[model samples]
Target: MYERARYWFDNTLARGVTALIGWLAVACLAVVIPVSALLVWTDERAPDTAWAKTAAVWRSVGQTLRLGGEVGSPLRVILSVLLALMALFYVSTIVGLITTAITEELIALRRGHSTVLESGHTVLLGWSDQIFTVVAELVAANANQPRSAIAILADRDVTEMEEELRSEVGDTGRTRVICRNGRPTDPAALTRVSPATADVVLVLPRDHPQEDAEIVKNLLALRTAVDDSRVRTVAVVRDAHCRLAAELAAGPDAVVLEIDDVTARLVAQCVRQPGLSVVYQELLDFAGDEFYVVDAPDQAGRVFAEVLRACPTSSVVGVAGMDGTLRLNPPATSVLSQGDRLVVIAQDDDTTVTTHEPAAFDESVMANRPPAAARPERVLLLGWNRRARHIVRHLSGHVAAGSVLHVVAHGSESLAAEVRAAAQAAPALTVTFGPGDPTLPGTVNEVDLSAHDGVIVLGPDHGPGQASPDDRTLVTLLLLRDRERTSGVPVRVVTEMTDDRNRVLAPAGAGADFIVSGKLVGLLMAQISQNWHLAALFGELLAPQGNAIHLKPAGDYVRPGHRASFATIVEAASRRGECALGYRTRGIARAGNDHEVRINPAKAEVRYWGADDEVIVMAER
Candidate 1:
């Protein structure tokens, strides 16, 4: 009975302020009334009559409880008690109002209910693993601008978003990151971030396939929230089928990048050239040489051949005419008339200066030997996943006829059917699927490592499961590396990982390449977010139908043991209808050296051309 009473009392105390006040008053009265009566009775000169003594005890209790205790007639005592009660009621009401006001204000702050009044800010909608990189890149891009701000609106808690961004992105420096709590798909909720007034709004995509529809809805909600059609918007969609819907909702000015197409293109390119991802990382980031459109008035009447050497600190890749059409690696005779912008690759916009002095080179040391013709190739794939079909199709498009791709994975009927469909889609190449577990040593060692030109290792989708996708990929990499060590064989290996931490933990060697799923998308989004023109530039660059970045033999341009300036290599490539960006040294990519890949070298910088060195260029082949 006592425990039950205590439990009931505890529940009542938790009810609210009214219950707490009632309990407090009962506690005070139980002790104060009895003590007051005892004091009055103990006094000798208290009251002679019984009625007088009772009234005196009541007066003492009233005075002790801070109610008015009048030592007069009954009417006077009753009026004083009434006045005291009114005063207590007024004070308690005022106190309750103030406490409520403070509590509501705190809750409003915690919920991020206030509207942002800043103009020309960047607005981000939705949340994903890409947020950290996007925020970090925004911080870097806004480092020079004063009082720049990035407002993020999502369904996550404001505090959680702030703390995670701080922990992942480190110091944001001058750029302020404001987080708001709301669903991005709701137009009413989207208004809190002021997307209409924002300079650019980015709609981030999540990992789930169903979230693609939500992203499209976000774009549509943005349409309802922002009346202005001029506001620039960038969105990402995982499925290619959803790209058209997202783009239509985003309007003509928006840029919608399909992640699957881009990922497939990158993986296909890396499979052929192990060192290509390194070049792309430098291109897509702000820290290194990237595409820039700058005026070249000085090269007005010069042919595109001479314009190649017009900049000492930059590489001229193409031109953008007044009509806004991009021309990458045009004919050698193409003229760079005044008013046409030069699409050059440089470390910064200011560095694309025209050099009046011509660069000197040793034409005597130039090699006239053309590159060997292309031949049929073979590829060995160790695993399969959602990206495998796209990889196979894009790889088939890049390789010559009679090329072969051998896939080894689980031989389940459903898996076999998927591989068979992908194989049937690529008519020019032959694809064979072998059933086995790639992580086992015998499965990898059974293949002839010397016959295949390259090997691709892909893991399953990353999430909660028996084991992580990264763990399986790393196991295969270790087995491949071990095979190379024991059998004295060398093979180019391209690995796909789901996590950045595990990507770094994977073993690295001369013929190994690592591609992180989210990191690449984050970098691409950041690049396009900073400069919208890059959207078209990257679109054309990654497409298989146009000119692409290629790493070619330095011996094909400049003979081995011959010294030449970068300008001479540029001229050599210009003769072949290509633009030479930079060169990579052989075996000089040790510590402190970034894999020996250098971009945007000065035109006058001379070096001894080695046979093993490769010249980076934009060419059709």
Candidate 2:
């Protein structure tokens, strides 16, 4: 019987607010009535009448419950209690309303539904691993500004994004990082970031099969939400086929970077010129000196050759004409007229000042040696991926006549058409394909490493099992490093990894190069977003038809066993019809040392020259 009554009471209590309120009233009355009766009975001075004492107890209960307690006739006492209960109800309702309103507002804020009112801010839409690199670069780029902000909107928890960003990108200084949660494709949600007034908007692609479609959707959504056409919009697409769609959706003003194309060109370039990756990395990262297009109106009507010696602190690599024609490493006779912008490599925009004083150099230290012969190269490709074919085509453009390329991948036969086309287009390259799994035992040694001038290692294009693409790439990289140790022959190997974190595990040889696709592409997009002119400038730099960056022996320009001023090296490069940007010091190729590449050093700075220390220059090799 007791258990049944307890169960009934528990069930009633669980019936929610009304039941809770009833129980609360009952509990208060139970304690107040007992205490009130006890006080009335134990009082030293009594009312001296039973009816009066009962009335006093009732009045005490009314006082404890905050209802009017009156010692009067029944009708008047009842009216007072009724009025008091009415006032209490009104007060409780107001308190409840205030608390609920405040709670709702806090929830909305936590949901990231508030609109941002700042102008000239950067907005990053979508979430990816590249976001960390991109945000870090943006912070560095805006370090000179007094106040700036980077707003991020993605379909993620607002607190989660903020916590992760704080952990990844610490000490933003005056720059603020704001996060909002919503689908990038939702036009209504886009207003939360106020993209219409944003200085620049970067649409980052996801790591999914439908990433291209997602990018297009985001562009269209941004189009609907952002009516202002002056805002800079930059995005990336992995596949070349989706480039046109992405561009169209982003409108005519947006700059869209193709991942496969950029990675292929970089891999092709790195395999040919070792340490070029480090050079490009320095140029692409905003933490160091990078490409900048600034107007130098005072120095108009000067020839390109004379302009080369104009800047003591910066390097002049190209010029963008007012007519939209960009000339990188233009002819010495080319003139920079009024309204023309100089494309310089410098630490900052304001620091690209040109001095009148001629730079000093020791001309006696110049090497004055003949150029090395361009022999045909035998390149062994250890793996194939979605970018393998494009890499081969780009390799053809840089190699000499009669160059040989043998592809040993798990399914190289499937890439026969691409190999044949690349070979047919260049005629100089003889390409072959054969089936081989790089992860299998004895497979790497079977493809003799000593026979090739350079090796290209491409991660799997797709993950087919428990192991990921980067895992396979790591396995292959381990094999190559082991072979190099046993054979004692340094092999020039360019490795492609999907994730940047895996780079630490790969053995670092002087010739072993890495091109982290996500990070590099993120840096490129960030650069172009900041300045659209860089799109054309980088295109010219990476294009096969024009002069690209190269790393040649320092002995080519300066004699070994002597310290030489950079001005002397610049003069030597000028004589060779090239622009000397910087140099990689000798003995910097061992593991854990990444400070080899230095660009745009002061012309007066002196360095102890070595035959092996390569000079980084923009040249047509």
Candidate 3:
């Protein structure tokens, strides 16, 4: 019996303090009511009347009930004191319970329990380091709208995500960003963001080994949860082989980008032609001129060349068919069918207007076109990384048969083996590797830098026992610049930087072309998020088999040192089965100046072209 009583006491005390207080209040009430009733019955304040005893008992009970009201006897006073103590205990217990409940609810709120009621907002379905860039771009894109919102759903702490966004993207202008904690692949979690009502969905690939698989699963989940076909979806898949699976899961209406393929093609193009990445960045990012699809009913039956002359503010680059076909720089004689859209490059979507007045063309200065030269190239590659193999393979596709590529890196044997494996698919060009550290001046001097036609510097991948990747790249760039200054060699240098901020710190006179990986991906994703049709457009432009952007000699189209109108240049390029977009003049190309490489210059304006000036064109070869 004693052991049972002890167990009962321990269990009762182990109950929460609030529960103990609740039990104490009940016990106090039980004792206080009976004690007050007994004191009322034995009160000696009765008068010599028939109802005098009943009245005295009632008065005693009332005094005790009022929590220590005026008492007439010693017994009544003691009961009142006990009743007051009980009331204090009851009030304290109620306050404690209320405080505990409030704390728990606050914690739940911090964990993201509230549901979003926003409609027509952009929804970001995953999280990574690229989120900052994506958010900043979206904010700028939505700056003119009075009310814009971006909701992020990720499997992370809500408060932490908010704090990181606040630190990275300070002011959002009129845009509001909301964060929720949930697994993107879970259907139940997706409902919290109201995907059915969203304007668009962007699935960011997570930073993990199984990132592609996770992205496919998330895309499937989003497809299953939303029934609206009007809402557009964009996703990124890292592996090329997994792109088919992701596309199948996302359906035909969705856009799925292959990260490796795009990056490889971009690096290949940039390495071959310097300043190409800058043009791509301007086209992809919203801060500058971007591609927009606009209806041109007035020119439905007009030829493609006429459409180019009609748009003064915008540059007509391509045509988008109603059947979802994108033709960039198609044949000039191709007729624009009814219901077709013109893919034009403009500062804003609303700024793509067609002017009725046509600019006069100078047919007198137009000259016969010359055949493209097939000169052998001697290229030098500094350092090695994961993208080096892709760069080499793509470079092989663009160079002549007798061109040679020399690779200088730390692990020469391993890099050579990898290059050999990559080159087996394309055996036209020869590749060789040498052992040396390109960042050191002595090692750089050993290799004859003046002999190469172009130099491509790759950022270090591992950075083991060395500075950061960007720091190492900067050192190599400085060394190469010094070499060029000493030798007076005019070798074009193309560099890869992991961070975008480091691009600003590079030497000004070096004339190096910077390709920032993260920022480039972020810009592409942002552009596609706004318009899903751009995915296929960019894919076709970057693919090796389709029409690609090229910088050819301006002398090929017009006479050297002769003044010719831009319209005459366009007409000349059309004769060669190509489309002329812009030109880069000799001694005029700068790092950050966009006008130095002018795109969509006035057709009537006559300008003298130098012998070494390059004309930017879109061609299949």
Angstrom error of the Cα, residue 19, model 3: value is: 18
Model 2, runs deviating above 4 Å: 1-10, 26-84, 411-427, 462-468, 589-591
TM-score of each: 0.87, 0.88, 0.82
lDDT of 2 at 489: 84
Top candidate by TM-score: 2
**Model 2 poorest ten-residue lDDT run:** 586-595
Q: List the residue pairs that clash in candidate 3.
A: none
Write candidate 3's Cα lDDT for 1-621 as tens digits: 999998987788788897687777678668766775566556575465645554454455555554555355768767867887698679879999999999999988788767789999999999876788899999988888999899999999999999999999898989999998899999889988888888888888655325689999998899878855555888887667678999888886678877656676777687677778767776777887787888888888888877777776677878899998988888889999999999877888888777665545666666676676788888898988777777777888888889888888877566678867866765767887788888888888888877787788887763335666888888988887787788887557787776677888875243456777767777888888777678877788877788888888888888888988887787778778777777877676355443356776666667898887888888886
Worst 10 residues of 1 by lDDT: 586-595
lDDT tens digits, residue span 325-433, model 1: 8888989898877788898888876778897665666688788997877789899999998888999899888898989999999658999999999999898889998
lDDT (Cα atoms) of all candidates against the true structure: 0.85, 0.85, 0.78
lDDT of 2 by residue, 426-479 (tens): 566889877789987588888878889889988877543445588888888888
Q: Which stretches of candidate 3 lie over 4 Å from their true place?
A: 1-102, 208-210, 227-231, 412-414, 460-468, 507-509, 560-565, 585-595, 602-608
